[model samples]
Target chain A: AQSVAQPEDQVNVAEGNPLTVKCTYSVSGNPYLFWYVQYPNRGLQFLLKYITGDNLVKGSYGFEAEFNKSQTSFHLKKPSALVSDSALYFCAVRDMGSGNTPLVFGKGTRLSVIA
Target chain B: SAVISQKPSRDICQRGTSLTIQCQVDSQVTMMFWYRQQPGQSLTLIATANQGSEATYESGFVIDKFPISRPNLTFSTLTVSNMSPEDSSIYLCSVVPGQGAVGYTFGSGTRLTVV
Candidate 1:
């Protein structure tokens, strides 16, 4: 079985400052990880993913995440935050060895980017 | 990436009533999933919709309570039957377009308020 963990319930950052939302995972096999953002009453938008290759992966809206194999973590990051970026973020993971398997989600992290 | 449209955006129904939520994708996808989000919470996988096959539900979810249908690769529906106030939740439909992409794309969601 695969599972994900988002340690923070909420994260707050000031505009122009860097931000980080932490995520970790537990999987029996290799991990396929992803990040998504959700606005109020709207569907979640794809952010980025870490499948293989480099530890650093860049994604939509100038966001990126680092995949640390040793730590079993995939942390979403942005150099500068925007007030409009405030939203709920989710981290998901699945076992790479499992074919067409459903993803397991973390509890979620609410981000509040203040101007 | 696939674009998904879900409706009835929201609905309030009396107890013992039923509601069906629809999801249509721009492109055909093999894997369609239904998830539920309670107030102020993360998402929980309800079931996986497959064409010609009955939906595969997760633990704690049953077909009698939540029925799903996948008439084609691009369309699916989820119905909540004999609903009660406990069934009130934000139900979302998601899809994985194909191999290579890491995360899932979601529909705007249906906010169901059962009274």
Candidate 2:
């Protein structure tokens, strides 16, 4: 079985400042991790993913995530937060060894970037 | 990434009624998944639909209450059966185009409000 956790329900950051949303996972096999953002009245947009290769991966909208194997974490980060970045972020994970396994999601972290 | 079209975008239904949300993908996808997101909450996997098989539902979800259909690779539907006020939520559909796809493409989501 695979599961994900986002410890914080909300993260507040100032515009132009850095922001980090934490995520952790528990999986028996290698994990395929992903980050998605849901803006108001819009579908979720893919942010980034960490499947293999580099531990750090860059994604759309200048967002990035670091895959920490030791910590079992894949935290989403942005160098400079913007007011537009205020939205709900979700971290998902699936077991790589399980063919077409459905992704399990965390509780999510709501990001609020103030002007 | 696959482009998904889902609708009715938002609906308000009377209690004990039902609503069927459809998802059409631009490209062929072997698996389609249905998820539910409550207001101000995270997402939860409801089921996985394959073209020729019945949907495999996650724990706490049942096929009778949330029937799914996948008659082809690019199209699927999920019906909210005998809905009650508690069934109001944002229902989303997602799919992976093929192998080597790291992240799932999601539909804009259907906001169902059971009154």
Candidate 3:
């Protein structure tokens, strides 16, 4: 079984400041980690993913995530937050060994970029 | 990346009525999935919509209540039967463009409100 945990339900950050949303996972095998954003009344947009190779992965809308194997974490980050960037962020994971398995998503973290 | 178009962006239905959500992909995809996102909650995989085969549902979800149809590789539908207030949620369809793809593309969700 594989599962993802987003420790924070909501994160507040000032505009122009760095923002971080924490995510961690548990899986039997290597994990394929992903981050997605959902704006109000809209579908989810893919942000980035960590399958193999580099520990740091950059994504859409100036967002990035660091995949730390030792910590079992893939935390989303933005160098400078923007008010427009506020949205519901989700962290998902699928077992790389489990062929074509559906992704398991973490309870979403709502990010609020305060101006 | 594949583009998906989902219909019935939002709907208000009477209890006991059914709603069918449709998704059409621009490109052929190997894996398609349906997910439910309850208010302020994480996404839950409803089923894997297999082309030309019965959908494989996750635990706590039954085929009778949530019937799925994937007649071909580019299209799929999910019908919510005997709708109730508990069934009010955002339904989303996702697809993997090809095997070993790092990210999956999602459609604009269908929001169902049962009254």
Candidate 4:
């Protein structure tokens, strides 16, 4: 079965600094990756996705992820972190072999942007 | 982009009772999915709700425990039956409007706390 792994449970970053939330996936075929954010008492929001074409996929709120095929990693990054950007982040993957297959998500990374 | 609205945003239910969470999408969608997010945990897909067909549940979830209904293309519901403390979690509804490895939009999850 395909699975995504977020090794870090939490990541602490200072305000205005660059931030990276690591994500790695294991799939039998090509992987379709995505990133989502969740604030307290709210639903998950779409951040970005990597279907094909560009390895570096940019998303909402100035977030981007680099899809590394060889390393099997799709890490979420932001150029300048904001205090409001602190939330729980999830990395998800879907196999490219079939269309109906549901996404497999990682354990999630809690980003705490300290002022 | 489809806008999804989920009802009963947060509810405290008693054990052995059931709670049915509704999901209404702004537009028609072919694939609707249900997921559970335990506190401080990643999402686990509960089932795929298909219109005019029985829901396809994932491992560790059953139709009896979590009955789902997809009466039409734009509406669906997931009910947590005979609830327990372990069933206390956020239930999310997701939909992918198109085919292929595209990203999905999620509703503002229903947070259920069983006691």
Candidate 5:
């Protein structure tokens, strides 16, 4: 079974500083990785995905993730964090073998960009 | 991108009763899925809603407990039957519009609180 791990339950970062939310995945085959954000009382919004391409995948709202294949990690990052960026971040993975497989999400990391 | 409209964004239901949540997507999709997110938790896929056939449920979820319906390519429903406080969760609907591993779009979600 494919699974993802978000080690940090909460990451506290000062606004305007760089931020990183760690994510590692385990899959039998190549992994399809994604990052999603959830605001208060809202559903998850897709940020970015790594299907097959460059190691660094850019996503919406100035977010980017590095897909490290050897390390089996897809970490979300931002150059400068904003106060509005404080939200729950989830890392998800699905097996590349099948298109119909549902994504397996990590426990989630609560990003706190303190202003 | 596919847009989904989920009905009854928030609802309070009595225990032992049932509540059905509906998701309507703007475009035709090949795959639809139902997920449950308990408070302070990530997401657990409940089932895959396949059109014109019975839904494929994940482990620890049953058809009698959470019946799903996918009447068409753009619509799906999930019902939490004989609900309890433990069943209180945010139910989300997801769709794969492109039928590929690129990504998926999610509905806003239905927050159900059993009392």
Candidate 6:
């Protein structure tokens, strides 16, 4: 079975400061990791994904994530947080060997960019 | 990437009534899925919508209570039967667009409130 854990339920960061939301996963085989954002009353928007390449992956809205295999983590990051960046962020993972399997998501982390 | 349009963005229904949420994709997709996001909770996979067969439901979810219909490749529907307060949540539809490894695309979501 594959599972993801977002250690923080909420993260507060000042605007223009770097923000980081932690995520870690457990899977039997190789993993496919992803990050998504959901604004108020809106659908989830894809941020970025880590399949099988570079350790660092950049995504939409000036967000990026680093996939650390040794640590079994994929933490979302932003160089400079914006007030609009505040939203619910989710980290998801699936076994790469498990073909077409549904993604197992973390509990989610609420990011608050304080002005 | 494929675009998805979901109907009934938000609804308030009486207990015991049913609500059917629809998802329409702009292009053909191989894999479509339904998920539920309870208040302040992570997204849960309800089922995988097969194009011409019965949906494959996840554990703790029954076919009788959450009937799914996938008449074609571009469209699908999920009906919530015998609605209760516990069923009040945001239902979302998602699809694996081109490749299985790429991230999935999601619909705007349907918010159901049972009273």
Model 3 clash pairs are none
Q: Candidate 2, residues B1-115: lDDT per residue as tens digits?
A: 7899999999999999999999999999999999999988889989999999888998999999999999999999999999999999999999988876767889999999999
Considering summed lDDT, which 10 consecutive residues are worst modelled in model 5 chain B? B95-104
Candidate 2 stretches greater than 4 Å from native? none
Per-residue error at A100 for model 1, in Å?
Answer: 1.4
Q: Residue-wise lDDT of candidate 6 within B2-112, one digit each (tens)? A: 999999999999999999999999988877999999999999999998787889999999999999999888999999999999999999999988765467889999999
Number of residue pairs clashing in candidate 4, backbone atoms closer than 3 angstroms, sequence gap of 3 or more or interchain: 0
Model 5 segments more than 4 A misplaced = none
State the fnat of candidate 2 relative to the true structure: 0.90
Q: A3-115 in candidate 2: lDDT tens per residue?
A: 99999999999999999999999999899999999999988888988999999999999999999999999999999999999999999999988877678899989999999
Better of 1 and 4 by lDDT: 4
lDDT (Cα atoms) of all candidates against the true structure:
0.92, 0.93, 0.94, 0.93, 0.94, 0.94
Report the lDDT tens digits of candidate 4 across residue range A13-72. 999999999999999989889999999888998999998898999999999999999999
Candidate 3 Cα deviation (angstroms), residue B10: 1.0
Give the Å error, residue B93, model 5: 0.6
Residue pairs with backbone atoms closer than 3 Å in model 5 (clashes)? none
Q: Per-residue error at A115 for model 1, in Å?
A: 2.0
Candidate 3 docking category?
A: high
Q: CAPRI band of model 4?
A: high
lDDT of 6 by residue, A1-115 (tens): 9999999999999999999999999999999999999999999999999999899999999899999999999999999999999999999998988888788899999999999
All candidates: TM-score of chain A: 0.98, 0.98, 0.99, 0.98, 0.98, 0.99
Model 2 residue pairs with clashes: none
- Which candidate wins on DockQ? 5
What fraction of the reference interface contacts is present in each model, in order?
0.87, 0.90, 0.90, 0.83, 0.90, 0.87
